[model samples]
Structures are given as C-alpha cells and as structure tokens.
Target: MLTVDNLVKSYGGAGRGRRGGGPSEPEPDTRAVAPDGSRVFAVGGVSFTVEDGELFTLLGPSGCGKTTTLRSVAGLERPDGGTIALSERVLFDSARGINIPANRRELGMVFQSYAIWPHMTVAKNVSFPLDILPSSRRPPRDEIDRRVRRMLEVTELGAYTDRSATKLSGGQQQRLALARALVIQPEVMLLDEPLSNLDAKLRESMRFELKRLQTELGLTAIYVTHDQSEALVMSSRIAVMNEGRVEQIGTPDEIYGRPATRFVAEFIGTSNFVRGTVASVRGDTVAVDTPDGRLVCSGAGAAPAVGAEVLLSIRPEAVSLARDPHPGAVNQWAGEVLNRAFMGDAVDHVVRVGAQEIRIRSHPTESVEPGTRVHLSADPARVTLVPA
Candidate 1:
C-alpha cells in the first residue's frame, strides 16, 4: 500500500574534519553524521513497496535509518530526494515538488513514547484525531462515543476509558495509544518502535496482540524497530537496512535462513564466522581448510574459487557437540571445552578448536565440561560461505 523510492537524507558538511576523525564529514549531498562517528542518512537511498494490508518492517541497528525512513514517510521530515506513494496517491515526490502534509495523508502513527495527553481521558485521546475530519466525514457524537468505546474494548482498555492517561501503566498507555491510532480507521499505520518502552515480558505479549489487531483490522503497517526478533515475529516481510541503505528484503524465514549478505547473517542471529581457504568444489558442496580441519559446506549463493579465502557463517545451534566422534561427517572439529554457560533450556559451550573459538549449543542434559575433549560436527547445508 506504500512505496518509497531513492530516498536519501544526510547531515553535516562534506570534506570538513571533526574534533576527532569520525565518519568522513557528510558529503555535499550526503546526510550529516551523528556525534558518535556515525553518519545519518537515516533513510538513505531506501526503496521498497508494502502490499495492501501487509505488515512490513524496517529493521536494523541504531542509526540504521529505519526510524528516519518511517518519519520521512509520515511527512515528519523532508527527504533529500525520493518519492513516496500510498495506494497510488502521491504523498511525496521530490522531483515533482509534491509533498502532502502529514495530517492530510490519511495515516495513523504510534510513537515510541505514548503521546497521550496526561490531562485527557482514554475516550478523549481517541477522539482527538476525529476532530480534524471534514464535517461530512465526521461521525456524530453518539457514533464517535460508540466507536471509541468499541476500540477501547478491542484493545482491552474498556474499564479505563474514563480514567486519565497519566495514571495508566506503560503497557496500558501503549494500548491507549494504539486505540487512538486505530480509531481513525487509517488505511496504513506507521509505528515507530511503539513497544520499545515495555518490559521484555510485556513486549512479547504485545507483539502478538499487535499482529492480531492488524490482521483483524486489515491495516497496512510500516513498523520500524531495531529489534530483529520483533521484526521476525510481526512482519510479513522485513526490509533490512544499514547505514541508510536497504541491504535486503524478504520474508523472515528467508532473511534468517538464507541471508543475502554477511551483515544480515551476523546481525539476525548468533552466528559464528569461520575463516578458511577454499579447498575444493565438488557438485553442490565446497570444501574449505580451517585451522581445525577440512570442512565441507553447501554453497549459499556464490562459491568461492578454489584456494580463495572465505568466511563460513554458521549458527551456534547448527554445531553439534558429541563426546564420541562420528565415523563419517563432512565437517568435524576436535576441541577442548573452554567454558560453558547454562541458559535456561539450552547449554552454551565455548570450544577452543586450534586457533579458533567455536560456540556450540546443546540441550541442558548434555554433559561436556571445561577441559574435556569434544568433537563438533555441523550439517553441510547449514554452513554458509561468504567472501572474507
């Protein structure tokens, strides 16, 4: 339902030197860098489309421009260059000098901080947006009350409808904010880290609720967050951004299982990078020589030339640890346990294999202690090769 093309934003003067040599000063056409040696295009050259009723997410680390892009789409910030369209309506076109004001865009937004007025009650907060509605489009007072009451019920805040927003808990306030956004019956919802303020447990619960609400309402949503797990759980597709550019876009499974780049692989999960030299290529498998031993891995996308240096990305859970060695395995490494950490249902083992430290995950029942000899084997298909 929404599209952004060739979007770029930058801050600071290019070729200028900072007190310390940080990211090169923003170029004449580039966005300025933050004080932390990080540049902000916030949403640099990002392009993607969200299908009607689809929940799309922009995910990355802080300063990756996910939030900047969302704000730009909401007309909160002007873009350096780009076009934004919502369901064929031109919301922004830098070249055409077309920029629709935020209120006229027919979109709802939820902020990281609950932007509810402390003096307002839940019903009043939800009714605030409707005041801007054209007279013909505005609902009657009784109808507005009914809509607000129903929304509060949907968000499970019916009992608090008359209570002042300031008295509500964080989660409650968030629900109130969501009710207010949905009360407008917006075609699309722009959520900017709306759940970031909640505790871990509440955050997890709210994700499911948020997804359910979107599906029930069939609302197109552009969710921005730095949390990979949150994106994975709620989005129909994730547009992974880095340094203002969209690095990759795909379903959660695709982004996690077969990341397009090393950055995506490393950022999405606990991945182990194994430095090795390509030993040989046979059929679909590529063999590599590492400090520990020869390892065979399925070529993810590109197969490095024989003898070329490469890095293998493997998830921690993919490495299996055994006290007894397997007779015939494509990838095997013998290592001494360096340390072990118990994390609820799983045991994390740091194994020293030659000059490399490999992490392995096993069930809590497994018994391999520090100083013990252990063998690690991984499925060839689970190993992804990337240019070193």
Candidate 2:
C-alpha cells in the first residue's frame, strides 16, 4: 500500500521553499505568512492511501490542488511537511529528514503531454529508460530487449515497434507513452490528465482502455483528472478535492449516491437542490419543509433534529413526472412543465412548483409537453439531506 500523511506544499513569503529550505525544513503551518503579501498553497494538508492493485484518483477542478498533491507523491515537488511511504519503505518523512528525489522514487509518470520522442521508434522510446540506467544498475542487453518487447506487446504496440513515434495516431501515441512507462516496471504509476489531450469520444474510450490495462497488470496507480465522468468510470475509489483540501473519498457509486457535502453533490453530477428546514426526524428518515412542500427523505446519513436547516438533494433521474401520483406518496408536488427536451436515451423536463424549479429526467418515451400540468414525485429513498 502507498500512504500519505498530512502532505502539504505551499508557496510565497517567509519560507525558503521546496528545494531552497535551509538547515531545518519549514513545516507548512503558517497559514498567513505573507501578512500584507499574498500566499498561495497549491496543496494544503491532505492524506490518503492506495491499496495494492487499486486505481485511485484525485479529482477536482482547475486550481483545486489535485495535481499538486499528485506531484508531491511523484517526488517532483517536495512537501513542506508529511510522511509518504510505500508499504514498509519510507519515501519521505519530514521529521526524519528523508526526501527521495524524483528519479530515485522508482515511479512511472504519464503527463498531459505524452512527451514521446519523435526521433526514436516505438521500441526504442520504450527501451530508452532501461538503456540509460547506470552500468551497475542496468540489466543485461538481452534482458533489456526482452523487457521492451514484453511491454510493447502488453501495450498493444508490438505491431508498431519500428514505427516512428510521430507517425501514430492520438490513441496509438497514448498507448506508446504507456508502453514506455511500463517498460521500466515501476512499482507505482502516476497519471496526470494523461487522456486530456484526446477528443471527448477518444478520451472516453481511453478511460476503459486504461482501466483494463491497470487491472490486467495488477498495478497500483494514482490518476489525476478534472473530469468527473472519467474519474467515475476509471477509478476504484475517488478523492474529491476543492480549494487545496480533500472533501470526500469513496467508491464512485458511494460518492455519487451519498455525497458527504453539498459541494460534492453539486460537483459529482446534476441534481435539483431544494433548501429546507428540518421538520421532523423519524428513525433514519428526515422531513424537511421547503417552499414547495414538506419533503421526507430516507437514507439521509444523519438525522438532524427538527427546525434545523438543511438542503435536499435529489438526482434528476430519481424524479419522475406523472399526470397523478399514487395516493399519499411521501413526496409529491403539483407543477407545470416549463421546458422539455428529448435526449436520445432519456427525456428531461423542467417543472416549476411554487417558487422552486425542479428538473426531472425519465425514459425518452415518457415526455410531457411544455406548459402542461404535471405531478413531480421522488422516492424518499432517493432524496439525500445535506447540511445547510
């Protein structure tokens, strides 16, 4: 397992910085070191663990510090404080004064740019890392050749072994990059937006391809991306980051189905957010009063007491429109369809109820016309209450 404890990396004012820190490396405890000047923290204190053969992902928007955290683990950016370890080996320990350089970390990295060498053929590009190792550490020539060939075959680049790196298509080039990285047989792989360069369709295709490759090789990897869909599709578990901090970490389904925070609910996928005040708490269910009506939600993580303010989050797909709801449904509101769209696989409808506009998605065959009166009902099980 790979573990990170309280990792922190910051910049600006009152410190010698990553590489230039004097005798005693400074801890990243100064929140406002700049005083009058501005301080920027690319990565605030964050921690997580990657289990054996698991594909872990750091997911967030631009400037959220996801990439910074990944770089810290890769040893490309020295952290101000924290301990990073792979199994029993300590890669870095702030108190111990141990900081492994990037090259010595024995990690394979694929950046947004594949960085393929145009001059070298696919096979040569993959073999380059092993070929350049110091004589003492380098494998025999025949062994190096075997490793390169094996990687090329595993990455499905064997047919293009002698082909110039520049001659391949976007997808092929991506595979070539992976082949090169895998050739070194690093213990862990760090991928930073490795598929962002491809077009949308291609990017989606590569997500599956990468997931397959990671699973087949039983490789432990840390993937970083801003695309929520990509993270949901590829990662075994995801860490959602915002403003240099991790908001939540869980499997893709858990994060989407039960968001721990409002930001997570809003970030993971589209949902209709209804602000309400808790009216009652019965067992695991919570009833919140809104302008539209009283909403009773089950499966809400914690049952808040009556009169507490909260936000009701219900996914569009969980809500449905009907001419009339079954009698005495827990959540049912009368509304008029304001807009409708037929989205090949599903139909989307925006319904206006009292002062709230609720969006509902259902099967493509079930759509109501605009301005038509309708009823919106959501399963109590599907409604989640977020602390307001």
Candidate 3:
C-alpha cells in the first residue's frame, strides 16, 4: 500500500569520493547537483511499490542508496525530486512542495542499532510512542496499555515486560524495538538492517521470526538490508539496487533465477561467470560459445545478434556433477576437481575445465575427492545470459 515514484535524494559534496567498498560488482554511478551545486547523489531516480501485507525489501551493498531511499520515504531525508504516497495519501511531493514531517507520516521504523531506551522497561518502551502523541491523536491510557501488551505478546516479550530494556539479549532487544514500532499501529514499517547486530545464528533464526510476525499481522513493510540471504528468506519481493539505481525487482526466485543484469547476477548469490559469444538466437533461446564449451540457454530476455559478447551465469547448485558424462546432456564439460569443501548440507567442488574454473555443488553424499575427474552439466534453462 505504498508507492514511490521517481524518488531522488542526495548528500553533501563532502561525502563525494570513492564509493563504499564491499563484495560487489562495479557499476556506473550518476551524480546529482545539490542546491549549492555539490556532487550529491545518494539515490537517483527510483520508483517501486509495496503491495498490501507484503514485506518488500530494498537490498544492496552499503552506499547503494537502499537506506537513503528508505529514509526518504520515512520523511527523514527530503528528496531532490519526485513523489511518495501511502495508500493514495500523499506523504511527499517535491513538485508540489508538500513534504510531511517524519512523525506525521505515521510510519514505524526500527533502525540497525535497535535504539532501545536504556532506562525504560520492555512495556514502557513499547508504550512510549503512544503516550507522546497529541491529546487529539493519542489513545487513552487503557487503550495504550492494551496495544503495548498485545505488541509485547506478538513479539513474545510478555514475560520480560518488567525487565529493563538494556538487560535483554540482542535478539530480545531487537524484538523490543519491533514491539515499540508496532505499538504505534503504523501504516507501514521501515526496517533498516534490523537484525545486523545479532549473531549469525540469531540473525538466521530471527529472519523466520520477523517473517512470521509480518505474515501474521498482515503488515505492509519496506525492509532495507545488504544481506542477500536475509532478503531471500524474509522478503516477499526484493529490489536489487546498484549505484543508487534499481537493477531489478521481483520475487526472490525470479530475481535470483533470472537476474536482469550482471550486477544482480553477482550480487544475489555465488555464480560462476562464463564469458561467451552469441552463436545463434532462436526466440528466447540463445547459444553462447564460451571458452570452456558451448552453452545454450533458454529464457533469455534479450535476443542478441550473432557474435555479441555475453556472460553466462551459472549457480554452483545448477551444475550437476557425475563420475561419468551423460553423453547427451547440454552444456557438458569434462574437468578435474581443483578443490572441494564439505559444507554440511552439500559439497562444493571447483572443477577446472580447459581454461575456466567452474564451481559445482553436489549432494553431501555424492562428494567427489579433489583431483578426481568428473563431468559437469547444467540445464539450458538454468543458464542465464548477461549481455556485455
């Protein structure tokens, strides 16, 4: 129930320089001119919609403008251009000069730090938002208490209601932050790396917890994070952002299985990129001649001309390994395992073929020792082509 149209935001000239470094592919970036003519473009023109009861996510590496976009919608950052609305109600419109105050937006937000009030107890923290409202807008004390208690129950913090906020564990503190946000009954919740502070195991477990909470409450939310796995596990749909622009937007399956760009292909998961040239094209099917072998891929969005340079993205899980060649399989290659890793659930094998190194993920029970000869094959449908 949220719409952002051509939303743009920028930072000061002092923040311009090398972009944030991380494990991401390099993409072109566009700069904007602030009112004072400084190089500022934290978020270029971006547009997306969050359907009702959907947990939509803006996912990317740091400095990719995911957080900037979220803050702009939260009314924390005034956009340089564009309009934002919640359920047809205008929240921001640069052309109309109608920017609402952050509090007036009626949106809930949980930051990366949790922001739990140290001196307050669990129940008090959740009730604080409702208690501070104007008399006309504020609920009665009994109503506020009811909301706070229900929010605590939804977050499974009822037993800890009297405990000081600072005394809770990291995950508990995060839930307390969420309880506080929900107590306000916001139209939409904005979460920016809400689980980043937790341990790895806690972070994984909280993904399901957060997803369950959103589904059960039927909450429409916009989540921002750099964790692809988290986005895949928790988001109803993901917007893959790069250099302040959204490279792709779709369900996790569609985004990961059919990435629109190389940045998305590389960002979402571990992919073995194979450079190739278009040998032929038949409708949506394309055949790319890589150094390793010929790869015929179906479901290609673009029809490239013959001899066009392209990159083929193949997930390790998509590559099937066997001791013997299937003889009639597509995109089959013969190689020797360069290295291997036992990943509990599966075994990862790095196979060297011709001059290319391809990663293959096989069942744990089907582990092939390093230095062993093997056959690798991937279905044409699983091989996606990225136009260079």
Candidate 4:
C-alpha cells in the first residue's frame, strides 16, 4: 500500500519556500508565516492510502491541490512536511530527512500530455526508459526487447511497433504513452489528468480502457482528474479535494449517494438543496423543517440533534413527479411546473412550491408542460441530511 500522512506543500513568503526549506530550517506550525506576508498551501495536510491493485482517484476542480498532492507523491514537487511511504519503504519523510529523487522513486507517470517522442518508433518509445538506464541497472538487449514487445501487445499496439509515434491517432498515442510507462514495471503509477486532452467521446472510452488495463495488470495507481464521471467510472475509491484539503474519501456510490458535506454533494453531481432546521430525531430517521415544508429523511449516516440547523440534499433523479398526488407518500409536496428542459435521455423540470423551487429529473418522454400543476414526492431514504 501507498501511504501519505499530513502532507503539506506551500509557497511564497515564510522563512523559506517549498523547495528552500531544509532540515536545518524551523518550519512554521501554521500557514501564516509572518505579519508582513503569508504562504499559499498548494497541499495542506492531505492524507490518503492506495491499496494494491486499486485505482485511487484525487478529484477536484482547478487549483484545489489535487495535482500538487499527486506531484508530491511522484517526487516532482517536494512537500514542506509529511511522510510518504510505499509498503515498508519510505519514499519521503520530513523528519527523517529522506527525499528520494523522482527517477529513483520507481514510479510510472503519465501526464496530461502524452509526451510521445515524435521521432521515435512506437517500440523505441516504450524501450527508451530501459535503454537509458545506467549500465549497472540496465537489462540485457534481449530482455529489453521482450519487455517492450510485451507492453505493446498488452496495450494493443503491437501492430504499430515500428510506426512513428507521430503517425498514430489520439487514442493510439495515449496507449503508446501507457505502454511506455508500463514497460518500466514501476512500483506504482501516477496519472495526472492523462485523459483531459482527449475529446469528450474519446475521454469517456479511455476511462474504461485505463481501468481495464489497471485491473488486468493488478496495477496500483493514483489517478488525478477533475471530471466527476471519470472518477466515478474508473476509481475503486475517490478522495474529493477542495481548497488544498481533502473533504471526503469513499467509494463512488458512497460519495455520490451519501455526500459528507454540501460541497461534495454540489461538486459530485446535480443536487437540490433545502436549508432547514432539524425538528426531530427518531433513530436513524430525522425530520427537518424547511421553507417548502417539513421533510423526513431516513437511512442517512447519523441523526443530528433536534433544533440544529441543517441542509437537505436530494438528487434530481431521486425525485418523482406526478400529475396527481399519491396518497400516503412520506415526503410529498404539491407545486406548479415553472419550466422544463430536455436533457437527451432525461428531462429536467423546475417546480415552484411556495417560495422554493425544486428540480426533478424524469424520462424525456415524461416531461410536464410549463405552468402545469404537479406533485413532487421523494423517498425518505433518498433525502440526505447534510450538516449546515
């Protein structure tokens, strides 16, 4: 397993910058350095683990520190403080004064740009890493050739072995990059938005392709991306980052269905939020009084104390719309359809109830007309109670 504990990387101001700090320097305990200036923490106390053969993802928007954390692990960027280890081997430790060189870390990296050598053949591109190794560490020519061929075959690029790297298409080039990285047989792989450069359709397809390769090879990888669907589709578990901190870490289903915070719910996907105060707590069930009405939530993680202010998150797909009210429904509200939008396979309707507007998604053919009266009902189990 790969472990990172209390990793911190900052820049500007302070005693010494990220790379300037040494074992002799006294590190500041907090982000603030002096009365005259402060530091920008690209990664502030971020921690997570990547199990063997698992595709762990660092997901967030730009400048959220996801990439910095990945780079810290890759040894491309040095951290201010923390311990990074792979199994029993310590790659970096601020206290121990151990910082492994990037190349010596034995980790494969695929960046946003494939960085294929246009002048080299596909096979040469994969074999270049081995060919440049010091004579003491370099494998024999026959072994190098075998490894390169094996990687090409595994990446489905054996037929293009002798072809120039520039001759391949976008997807082929991506596979070539993977083949090159896999040829080294590194201890772990670090992918930093490798699919972001591809077009939408290609990017979607590559997610599955990368996941399949990682599974088949039993590769332990840390993938960084801002795309929610890509993380949900390809990761075994995801760590959601925001403002240089990890907000939550869980499986895709857990992150999507049971967001730990409002930012997670809003970032992961579309959600309708209702601000309210907890009215009652009954075991795992809770009642919240909102502007729209009283809502009951069930099967959530834990119940908050009564009278506490909270926010309720309900997914658009979790809500059901009807022309007539269904009697005995647990959480039902009568409203008028304010607008409707066709979203290809699904249609979204904005309904106004009193002073609140709720968005509900349904089948494209089930769209309701504008200004039509409708009823919105949601399963108590689908309504999530988030701490305000």
- Clashes per prediction? 9, 0, 0, 0
Model 2 scores a C-alpha lDDT of 0.86
- Candidate 1 Cα errors over 4 Å, as ranges: 14-40, 282-284
Say which candidate scores most in lDDT.
Answer: 4
Best by TM-score: 4
Instruction: Evaluate all candidate structures by whole-model CA lDDT and list the values in order.
Output: 0.84, 0.86, 0.88, 0.89
lDDT of 1 at 271: 86
TM-score of each predicted structure versus truth? 0.90, 0.94, 0.93, 0.94
lDDT of 3 by residue, 116-156 (tens): 89999999999999989999999988999899889999999
lDDT preference between candidates 2 and 4, better one? 4
TM value for model 4: 0.94
lDDT (10s digit) by residue, model 4, range 239-265: 998877788899999999999889999
Write model 1 residue lDDT over 1-388, tens digit each, in one string: 7888777666554432222111222222232345564543455567789999899999999977788889899999888777899877999987888999998888889999978998898889988888668899898988888889889999999998889999899889998999999898888899999999999999999999999989988889999999989999999999887776777899998888767678899899888888889898877789999877888888556576898998888888999999879789878888899999999999999999888799988999985889999889999988888668
Looking at model 3, residue 372 earns an lDDT score of 94
Write model 2 residue lDDT over 1-388, tens digit each, in one string. Answer: 9998777777776533332211122335454335754556666667789999999999999988888888888998887777899899899887798999988889999989999999999999999999889999999999999999898888888898899999999999999888888888988999999999999999889999999999999999999999999999999999998777788889999889888788899999998999989888888988888988888899776688889888888999999789876577889999999999999999999999998799999898898999899988889998988878
Please say which candidate is ahead in lDDT: 1 or 3. 3
lDDT for model 1, on a 0 to 1 scale? 0.84
Supply candidate 3's per-residue lDDT for 375.
92
Candidate number that wins on TM-score, 2 or 4: 4
